[model samples]
Target: MSRVIHVFRSPDRFIAGTVGQPGDRTFYLQAIHEKRVVSVMLEKQQVQVLADRVGAMLDEVRKRFGAPIPPPADEFTDTDPLVSPVEPEFRVGTMGLGWDAEAGSVVVELLALTEGEVDESVVLGDAEEGPDALRVFLVPERAREFVARAHSIVSAGRPTCPLCGEPLDPEGHLCIRLNGYRRGVHIDPHEAPDSDDDE
Candidate 1:
């Protein structure tokens, strides 16, 4: 079945945002152009990978085409939060990214579950066909904005234990680096423990 595609060219607003706090957060990518708005839900890893790729894409664009990159907007974070994101158009099943030669912009395509291919005998869990995709085009500066805000939101999650390089909860963590001996002990990731030299 042919999928419906919402294409936003040089979108006025394109950003990645989260709905909840830290550990329980839900990630979303929103694209807005005047009255038309398209929102989609995706995983945290997807958000992180997208940001990294977008940043790398910019560097490649510069070296390859000498594309002029606009100065990133003064504001890194969204001035206005996710708009009417309660009902996402779809939960993204797959995503495609590329540069548009004609438009001279980066295009992000988000796909949702494909309806036509569903079959009774085909085993529900595994399917060959992917989801329908929406294409969003953004200028260099706007893409940079997306990467910056995405990084900010993704990194704002739980603090990491410096010793074992693992996430630490608000209450603290039972650091695995110390092994089973420190099972009950909570290590505060943010605080620096002092050392005593005196014998």
Candidate 2:
């Protein structure tokens, strides 16, 4: 059977959010318009990059097509499990962003990961049979809101150690900058973990 593509045109909602706890989170991109809903899985880094790129895209659009109305408050869904029951449309392999000059929308194209080689059938226009893909078109202002919310979601994750740049649990981390010494860990006289850094 031919693969399906989910498209949300001028979605009423488009946002990036996470599911699960800070250290064990799964990032998701979701859109809703009319009766359609689309959700795709992505990496945390992808969320960050998507947000950053959206900001940049808006800037370019402004310079070229005059400024759009300022976006409303950067608000994402506060409810835990951004998308409940957690079913993903597809695991995103590549996400592409572009502007529709005629329609004045930011087009987000997500390509799914194929099992093997790419579908070369997508040469001129249509695809006869292809892997899953999702597309969402957001107005400039809505795009801005999505970007802001995305940043917030990414930052709400586990804190990073200032020294070694690794995620820090509430108990602290073993910072390589501290020569493999775990910050705030008691070095008991009885059983201290042997470390080459503890010279």
Using TM-score, give the best candidate's number: 2
- Kindly list the per-residue Cα lDDT of model 1 for residues 1-199, writing each as its tens digit: 5446777876889988889878788989888889888888899889999888888888888888888975444358465788874568888766667888788888887777554653433221223444545688888888988988988878888888889878888876888888846547568877857767776
Each prediction's TM-score against the native? 0.76, 0.80
Computed on alpha carbons, the lDDT of every model, listed in order, comes to: 0.77, 0.77
Show the colliding residue pairs in model 1. 112-131
Spell out the clash pairs found in candidate 2: none
Model 2 Cα lDDT, one tens digit per residue, 26-109: 999888776577889999999898888888888887877786745445665433445466579889876778888787888887
What lDDT, from 0 to 1, does candidate 2 have? 0.77
True-structure lDDT of candidate 1 = 0.77
Candidate 2 Cα deviation (angstroms), residue 132: 1.1
